[model samples]
Target chain A: MAKAKLEEIESPAMLEEFYRQMLFIRRFEEKCNVAYRLGKIGGYMHTYVGMEATAVGIHHAIKPTYDYMITAYRDHPQPLLLGTDPVKVMAEIMGRSDGMSRGKGGSMHVYDIERGFFGGWGIVGGHIPLGGGLAFASKYRNEDRVTICLLGDGAANQGVVFETMNMAALWDLPIIFCIENNEFAMGTRLEYHAADTELYKRGEPFGIKSERIDGMDVLSFHKDMQRIVDWTRENQKPYWVEIMNYRFLGHGAADNDRQLYRTKEEEDAAMKRDPIARLEEILLKRNVMTREKMEAIDEELTDQVEAIYEQADASPFPDASEVYDNVYTDMEPEKGH
Target chain B: MAAVEVATQTMSYRDAISKVLSEEIEANPDVFIMGEDIGRYQGTFRVTQGMFDKYGEKRIIDTPITEAGFTGIAIGAAMAGLRPVVEMMTMSFSILAMDQIINHAAKIHYMTGGQAKCPLVIRGPGGAAKQLSAQHTHCLEGWYAHAPGLKVVAPATAIDAYGMLRQAIRDDNPVIFTENPGLYTVMGEVPDDREFVVPFGKANILREGTDVSLVGYSRMTQINLAAAEKLAEQGVSAEVVDVRSLSPLDMTTINASVAKTHRAVVVYEDWKFGGFGGEIASRIAEESFDDLDAPVVRCGGLNVPTPYARNLELECIPDVDDVIAAVQKLG
Candidate 1:
């Protein structure tokens, strides 16, 4: 899982774009924590703070039309990278009508069908089979599309995951099982949860090509993912990626200041390899962006976050009648079946 | 109402389902079938007999023995604007995919603010037949009808089977169309041209009467009809309502009939306690409370796991005798 040389990026524009997107997500989650604590954004918010690079890298590696995604509750970065309006996402978090899910699905269940991002599932391991199914359809229709089904280490324990893996492998579905093995499933450490902590080998029984990569480095993640996606796309075979990553925030904003789950030494050890800080270091060392340019990008993202907050604050809460609407498509029945 | 025209050609219930599937697939490219043992093997029950030869492997998929996986895939494909007919070899197998059927397919359309609609149909044989014990025999249409987001349809006759399946395939919402294994061999006339489609939420008044209204769906509809004839012998003119669609239940039809009949007996093959009968009873009680001259009696299977013995299984299922008894009690 060695990091790629900075010179490998032919154009610094793509690298800068990726860095900015990752930074925006980081800052957006930070703002979400502030808003959530102040009683603005309510109900279950799982932040993708440390695992931004993994999502950003893989999301950028494929076309939106050809690729569909389903992930666990740690999902804020996905919709943003998939081109959902940031203001709408913020508004939805605030339970406003303008939100991505029209205030029904707050933090966890953001869905953008137009953008080809299916949804963020709250139930662990529930969407694993769904992701596989999406890939199965792609291959069945001869669409030449691949679905990147993302999940955390906790979801890997689900029987449906293995069920889907075996079925996906047997069917030769064009799906990539992206496991963001962030070293912990909430408070339970990986060692305690999984017998063989190497999550990539979980795909071995299904004969799905598996790879373990340094999830902190965007370049490593992107390069490895590109290879896997291309292979899956060409061969229409399922593959797996075990991302060795960590989450900076607690399981949720609710878990803040509770260090009883882990020792301070372990927390500090993970903090030193902070994905954002490490990426910034790499950028500066490789001269992708000067210190001033990095500062400008940070300032721009801060302004965007502020604007998003303002827009959300201004948007109205969903109408009371909306609770009953949209449960089924209010489509008028056509003339014939 | 026009009587179903008796045609020279007749098909089995299994063939009716197959015809509906084939017609829908031929008419619309978006329509496809996916299930275990459905492709090269034709099907475990052979419901999709020549679908592989006609539509090829892509349209008639042979999935791994992963109900949850393929069901989920059907739901996803439906969301993406494909009409997917997912067959659970038996209702018991559907239990494995209940999460997707209930949570994803049923709830996603509403959860996504109507941006996604699952035009998915999960159809299969249900209920006790021969020696298939507790594990294999499960009448789950009642369970599915309880969910608000899904359309639950159980078509007993060949015409309703073909017509309702066509409707289910084209429905914008998720639908559970349960068939009966025992009824697969039941022969009935079917039109060659694929034009018939029964509307959802519409109940058929099999035999209009004034004494009592007997409600049933799927194979139970036939049992209720038989009971109605017996009830007539005892001077109880039982009006029979074949409830083809359960979720979007024709409350209008049931309420009107109860008002006229003054007494009702709900017959179901599902176990007692929280079965689909409860909903119908509640609806009748709520809408036509003053119309009832007698208490609404419910006739259903015994509330216990069905045993393997033929006699015990027969004892466990709601039959024509049970319907007669229930209607007599209403008198």
Candidate 2:
């Protein structure tokens, strides 16, 4: 059964907003993939095609100002969901001067401190302790701010993750550890990698409150996440949320080899459980939105994506002279002591 | 009349660090300390004693035994506009936090193109102590000094500890304060004025001499000074220059000293291979090659894992004899 909040939020306007944002993220990512294919975007291009609900659902769980978020390399949706303009995010993926990072950080290194979204770490399980540290500071400062550290199922096996979980439990720091368990990390299955595949139960030894949710259902994700986020903010401790999700595409644009490791039958089965499809089903049944309204929202998003790509394409790259700036503080060392 | 400021009486290195932390914490709202057993337990070495009782629990946080986790937290907090003072218990433990130190703290400013600055300090006791052995007894300040992003400070005296720590806390970049366990109890006079902040990368000349320039940091600075005193008795004037900050190295002062004295001896307490002394030697040899007296001499601990035995621990580190021999060899 869904929670009261899920039942309460039956407004068509809200549904339209959700569809708009989710469609914007999906279209922007698709544009980036095309841009990368056309050589306009360089380096890695990891899209969030089918995992929009995990980003959209969790984005609704906590206030952006009070919560810090750190994610792994598959990170396009986070900046978008964290109040970043889809166009600027698209420009950042294109590596232009007008990008959020001023063209310095590509996809995996996006940082927007103003929105409390930390950089996208390329190293696996590396930012677990980092997120734990941010929460420690929040508790120390007596601020209600909590850090939401997102990692893949692959990163769950890292020793530092276990170390951070133990420490987070010991310190009672406010942090929400969300594992986007998309079944396969690149190519390896969760069960193929670890003996015990369940991440929520893995937190039992550390005494961290853990939960498993059907990540494909946006309502279930939002409701379940609210409980964990509330528990974290109230108790000022760590909580683990393992979101069982699936990515519709390969790991990156370059991985067109078609992930043969996982069966197509499994992929099709998970696709039928797609988050967007599930949300549309609920919206239609509730009569909050029709197919024509949903189509209009997507069309508006497609135009928005096109406008962003055009702006990003025309935007200049950073001049070579700007390379040496910002390595250190503006203040020079004071004269002889 | 300017009140002839009485030099606050001599204080131990431990007390000096406490006083520095006290004054800085009082003056700056940006500063706070975090580490395992720092609060309530009042720090394992008692460096943070009475801080919890004075400043309350929020400022002096006791974290779980997670160096990497807590260190990353400090780095992120630093990025988010708070100056955090992180204690690692020992330099050995800092290895676990290297990802945060190297990747995040060091790279963020450059990686983010000036949108972020990590005004953070990671400090704790370092170097060989009795019976702690292989893991705990290693002096790895050189490892940190090897990094380009961090400002590495290894204060040798009570005054330097007090002054450099204040400077480090105020620095806009990340600083690694490497306090040696061996010298934490050594007593010296520190300025009473809380405004005293020793600038990094400036070598402090403990003794002016016409003979070889003896360069060292932290505990080895004391050993060099001791050897200099011994040499003074035998009519050999040893110029003791403490290279306070290792990263923005005071190569200018070192090169000038070697140009005048015509010879130099570099000493450290870490393993000899890729030791800090090796860097010093290369710098001097490269810059002061024409002004030759003898080859640049290097002295450091033997290349081996530190043992638990007291005598072995003592043997593993460079002593006054080793300093004297290096000075004699330079001559």
Candidate 3:
């Protein structure tokens, strides 16, 4: 995707906002990594280090607090962009009482029902049909809302994904099937995992208007997503769009052996196209801010992320009395095993 | 209980469920039914016959033969404030959607910290028919009851099925409503009132006796009732306790029966080794050991997969004779 000319853009400040959002996510993920090492965050914590552009683009494209969204385990950035408190998100990761999910869901299961973000589902391709269902309800109730369902390239091969797309197209549900094709299904490379590596074509046989695009450039990605969202909203149809990107961190906090699948040479090549650096260059060319000013802002965001971690760490763990809570809304399960 | 004057009519088990489903769909705008072959084709079991003509396409949505997809779709719809009744062609087919049902439907409320509730009902016929063989004949209420966030109920009679189906539709959590295929044609008196709703976690004593407690649910309850008749002929009074709901298990009623009877025989059509019957038996041993005059015996289905042949299928399924034999062994 070619960069839009600065003259063609109406607001240059939005570009600066995009840079800051990506930078904050980067710093927040880095802090989560340190917290994981320090035994603060538990379970499989997947960071949004390299895929910030995709999430930022997705976050900006939808109607805040109106349109629905659902994604797989690697979820944090989208909710943060949608105005979820960073302290609650961090507290959820650290398994604290006042966290997003009362510390029961941990890192992979953040949910903000008030914001219309359905969940942070852990099962791969599990939430795809759920996304379709949200849209199905929207259309069923004659409501004007779109649901964006995100999945990984690995989850692309799940049978439920195809099943959902077929129904979404057949029923004309207002939903966007967004595939974050980051190329690695856990550790297995895409070429080895998928029969046909062109993941977007999975929706083509169903006659969905599908396309593959570059998700690295946040500005272009946001514009393209906005167009897709409007088309689905107006037409009440489903669109399958594959956002191609890369993950800079390991698959999760525990993935230490990088040599098993990828090489440093390929890693260096991907790093050169670092979305944060590329956006930073755009900001500099446009005179959004000087290098010193950017450094100061980065320091400020770093300190802000540190405070988020500390505030989350200070939050108390859930009381033992709540272990049986939420099992059912009105009834209790046979308590204590 | 006050003896209020209410009209009751005899209806088939299938019609009882259809009556409740139609009533709920008409009563609540949010209530809808979705499944494969449930629209124009009715249902594979014909449980939804004529429902499409009444509700039209939107309410009685026909889905692709994708259990996981539609199941998850129903869960999502439930999360968004719709009450969806998803009919599995057979409870055996629910295995294909276990990940969605157990992981998604069962956990959405708890995992989301009470933010989302999956108010959906997954209902269909279960257990062995004449020739469904191994794959099609599965009593899986035992498995669903094991999940924390799910409500599993297998009603044996048409009245209980009618009353419980209403409660399951109005319930705000995920419910696994399993009806045995063998009992769909069984006729019984069901109340005509739409207000009739059965509460869960309560066991019903079908027959009052003192010798032994014949405990079962779903189709096994019918078998236990038949066994009670034979036990009565032998001058033994066997108390039949029908465990309607399995998840929020009502030990109060069950242990009360065992306490009165002093001996118990848990009968289930599910495999004997790891079935929910074991849970009941263990609970009785732990909580009612002092009341027992004999050991708690469990007469569950044979461990092997049910065969297609008439004789072998009969061998695998626990029947009245099996229940009687198990009660005899309780001494």
- Across residues B189-286, which tens digit of lDDT does each residue of candidate 1 receive? 77776777888889999899988999888898888888888888888888889888887778889999999998988888889788988779877887
Model 2 Cα shift for residue B259 (angstroms): 2.2
Better of 1 and 2 by TM-score: 1
- Worst 10 contiguous positions by lDDT, candidate 1 chain B: B3-12
Best by lDDT: 3
Error of 3 at A5 (Å): 13
**Model 1 per-residue lDDT at A166:** 85
- Cα lDDT tens digits, model 3, A235-268, are 9999999999999879999999877999999899
User: lDDT tens string, model 2, A172-247?
Assistant: 8798888998887777878899788877898888888888887878776777787788788888989888898898
Best by TM-score: 3
Q: What's the candidate order when arranged by decreasing TM-score?
A: 3, 1, 2
- The sequence of per-residue lDDT tens digits that candidate 2 reaches over residues B41-138 is 98988899999999987678787777887887788778777889998888889988888788778777766666778999999999986789999977
Name the runs in model 1 displaced over 4 angstroms: A1-10, A330-337, B1-8
- Can you tell me which runs of candidate 3 are displaced by over 4 Å? A1-10, B1-3
What order do candidates take by lDDT, descending? 3, 1, 2
* DockQ, all candidates in order: 0.54, 0.48, 0.84
Alpha carbon lDDT of residue B44, candidate 2?
A: 86
Q: CAPRI verdict on model 1?
A: medium
A1-337 in candidate 1: lDDT tens per residue? 2236344542578778878988999999999999999999888898888878888888867886458887877878888988789998888778889987788888888888888888878878888888877887677678888898998898899888888888888878888998888777778888999999999998887788998998888877787777788788888899988888888878887786537567788878988877778788878887988889999999999889989999888999999867767666643221221
Chain B, candidate 3: TM-score: 0.98
